[model samples]
Target: MDILLNVVNYILGFGAAVFVPLIMFVLGLCVKMKPGDAFIAALTLGIAFTGMNTITSFMTGAIQPAAEGLADKTGLALTTVDTGWPAMSAIAWAWPFGVLCFPLLIVINIILLVTNKTNTLNVDLWNVWNLLFTAVLINYACEEAGMGTTVAMVLAFVGAGLMAALGIKIGDMWAPSIEKITGIPGVTVPHSMTFTAVLMFPFELILEKIPAIQNNNVDAKWLRDHFGIFGENSVMGLIIGIVLGAIAYGELQAALTLGIQAATAMVLFPMVSKLFMQALSPISDAVGDWMKAKFQDGRELYIGLDWPIVAGSNELWVLTILLIPVELIFAVVLAPIGNTVLPFAGIINTCCAVPALLLTGGNLIKMLILGIIATPVYLMVGSSFAGYCTRLAQTWSPDSLAGMGENPSITWSTMECPDFRWVLVNGLSGHVVAIVLLIVWLALFVLLYKHMAKRNVEIKKELGR
Candidate 1:
């Protein structure tokens, strides 16, 4: 047991950027790439991920202070401190059974791939804890319902398997959207974050029927053409930063500095995303060809990836950045309904924003609307999950939340990416309604898959493929 924990810790200690490229390198070798070629591809892939991580960190570091400042300006004290996703992740790894989720998830992924239930390989190793969190939560739920530890453990694994499959399907479904938006091919982002689109998908359908919202498409290109230099994401980012800076801190020099920084980050994203595409193209093709031969059915294989693959969208950043303060205000307004967790740590909220960007076809106005609509769900999930999250923290890292200023609970909006926080809460409450909700959720996915299949066909036609 100690050995297993040590090994898991060591591997994860390398972090997502280095770890993902290693997986790609091994996958490259398995698919029969020459070692030298695989090495080059792997290194390039790692570099791309590093760039994404660096920029993400840059944005978060730059933005969080203003976000926290906004929270301070609110002058309201919420009971639960939003420790963010890292706290949840740390708690998952600290759990003894956390390491066991890897094999369980892998076995499920293999069954899914072999049975043609899903094409995604679920190789985004770093985010496995997302499912692990569900497993741990379910384990507690079962135990709370008077099931013993052994039974709770079994049910937890069962829940994780279900979620793993759901996540894979979500990733497979979104591959076409990712390709359509980024023009990148043969790779799918299967992170739990994209699962939030499952909820956004319904709203998307409703908007589809309303021709006014559906027909009027406003994307980055549209902004660039209409607004000219100022419409460009870089310039808009500059303006937004100045506004946010002024809102948070009334200093002109600080606002200007933030404007320049935001502009630079916005412009650099496309360049790094291009490097990501360059690195991924060869590995993706190799895997697709290899799978076609191996399957004997001419089916293409898409390399499952992390969220950053799609995070390059200017639309995603725009929605996420703009919503940071708005979300905090919503939390304050919604406090009467048990929203105890303040929006402090996970303020950017790209997990939900990125998927909405794809689903709405990057209509800035629509994405913004969906974001506002979705904020309550996030608050509810975080507030509801706080007790469980706090228990986990108390069991594992008791001192971690001491400085956060209240009955601290983790607010990991990433896990709520329509990732079934409601379902988790229902199941944990030992209600039969959980079963109905689960069935409904899966049924929705069935319909979503069909929708995606048709959409993929249309996209292929458009691409002249």
Candidate 2:
């Protein structure tokens, strides 16, 4: 197990910039593309990922100061530190048993695909960490309940498989919405990050039924046509950045600098997205062709990608920037009620924003409310599980919390496990409340799965798809 785990980690350790391209290169050749063409496609994907990572660094550079400024200005001192998903993912991989989940999920995905149970060939293999983390948490719960290691691991792996299937279903339902919203074809985000949309689905649908909300047809494009540059996406980003900077720094110079940075991001994100779309085409075409050949219905196959594919939408960034102060306030308010997460590291919160953008069809009002609704949940989950996460970090990967303190509680605030999965796993620990909540969450998902398909269709027609 150690040898196999080391090999997998060595490859994945190269990160998405390498791992995704390597997979795509192999997949491209498997689908019968010429070696030269496959190489170009793979390299292009590598470049696109590299560019996205660079932009992410720029975003973090801008936001980190803003986060610090917000913390300083607000004077809040929540105890648990939010390390964000990257650190948490590393912690998941460090779990001695987590390596088993890597291959297990790969096989599960293939089985699901071949059985016609899920349409997504989830090539977003790096996110297997999400499943691993889920299982690790479940394993902890089972151990606390006095289960043996063998029983705990079996239960953990079972829970992880179910969650993966749920995510695949979500991605399948979400495919059309991605196409309708971003105009990107043959791609879907089947990763756990997108599972956040489930929280907003019913609420967005409710808002759609309200007369006032439904009747209001005004949007950014309308404002752009009538009011010109002020409504433009880049200008909107600049305005948001300036406002955030002012709130965080309380200074003109810093505000303008951040404003320019945000505007630059708004302009560059879409340009980079164009590169990704271009590079993904050949590989996507091959996958689509392969799927058609296998299925007589000529159904198209969508590549399950990382959520960053939709991060280019100015709507996503718009809501994300606007929510920073609100999220800080949420953390501060919830501090008294066991919510100790400070909302610092994962302050960008695209995990919620990406899905909200797609589910709401870029409707800023709906997206804003959806984010507001999800914030407390993220905070509470972070708080509820911080100690376990920290303990796991200490046992398996102490370096993860090295700089925090002697024994600081660490939490991945943004990528909170979807409500049902969390509750269901906790139910295994024999908590009556958790068991009841698990049932409620399952019922909700059952209904949600029913409506989401139809809602996505409505969204597609709205986009003229």
Candidate 3:
């Protein structure tokens, strides 16, 4: 176990940009891909990841200062600090079981695949921290309850494995539509946010039943046709930036700078994602061919990836920008409802809203309504978990949330945030209600899969499957 852990650390030490591509190159070679094609694919994947990091950095640099200014200007004495996702990740990696997470998850995936239980070959390893985060939360809970480290570790592995299995089911459900958009075969995003689309499935159906809403639906196609060039995501991003900037900083220069930044982020995200897809093409083909030949059947397998390839959808960007103000307003006016953490507009817009829109068929109206529903969930969860997060950080890595604020703790508006919080409240803390809710959440996923499967023929046609 020590040797395996050491090997995992050494490989992951290079970071995702290098490590992921290196692993893919090795896997490609093992799969009998041409040496030149495998090397090019791996190199291109690295380049794509590097470009993505650059764009994300620029977006963070532009939006974060303004967001901080906005929070300060509000003068709210918020007890809970918003330390952001990086802090949360730091806490995850610091936990003792963190060293074991990578090999455990990889082993789980391989087991599932060999047993024919899941066709999703999840390669989005960089986000494995999420699974680790879940594990640590459970581990902390189990330890507090007098469970032995071995038992805690086993439970942690169970939690992480369950999430991966859930991701496979989700990737299978959403892959066809994603393929249509990116023109890349056999790939889907299976992150936490995309999984939340399951929760929205029933609501979407209810909304569609109402002709008043359905007939008057203002979707992406409507925007493209009515607004012409102004409806384009780049311009919409600029407009959103100008609005956000003006709100964050009451100066023309500041507003213009922010507007350009938003526009650049909106444009660059899709562009960088396309580079990723291009790099993935050869490997995707090789895997698909191998699967069909080995299985002796034409199974529609998918690679579970991160949420970049489908970023091009105009509905996603537009709805995300529109929800920024809504999230902020909820944070301020709804403080009574535990809205301590001010919404980080940039992260929420990119991470939460886009996945919601994509899973709901890019229906802008549905997406907006989902955002409205999700706001309170974020606020209450973030606020409630702030204390636990603070304790965990102080106990595990005292400096993890340092420099955010005094006694700073972190929370997230990302799709995984609520689930993480709920696990803490229910799974670890022995809150029966949370456990029940989780059971219901899984039940909802089952219902959603069945519901979608009933319309399989229609969905496949729509997705060009």
Comparison by lDDT, 2 against 3, better one: 2
lDDT of 1 by residue, 323-426 (tens): 88778888889899888877767887887787787677689888988888888888877787777777887787777777765555565643455447568546
- Provide the RMSD of all predictions against the true structure, rounded to 1 decimal: 1.9, 1.9, 2.7
In model 2, the Cα lDDT at residue 439 comes to 79
> Per-model C-alpha lDDT, please?
0.80, 0.80, 0.71
Q: Give candidate 1 misplaced runs (Cα > 4 Å).
A: 402-408
Q: Worst lDDT window (10 residues) for model 3?
A: 412-421
- Model 3 spans > 4 angstroms off: 1-3, 143-154, 212-221, 401-408, 413-417, 420-425, 462-464
User: How would you order the candidates by TM-score, starting with the best?
Assistant: 1, 2, 3
* TM per prediction: 0.95, 0.95, 0.90
Ranking according to lDDT, highest score first: 2, 1, 3
Candidate 3 lDDT at 76 equals 67
lDDT-best of 1 and 2: 2
Candidate 1 lDDT (Cα, 0 to 1): 0.80
Tens-digit lDDT track of model 3 for 306-377: 776676566766676676667666777878766677766334456567556655666677788877777666
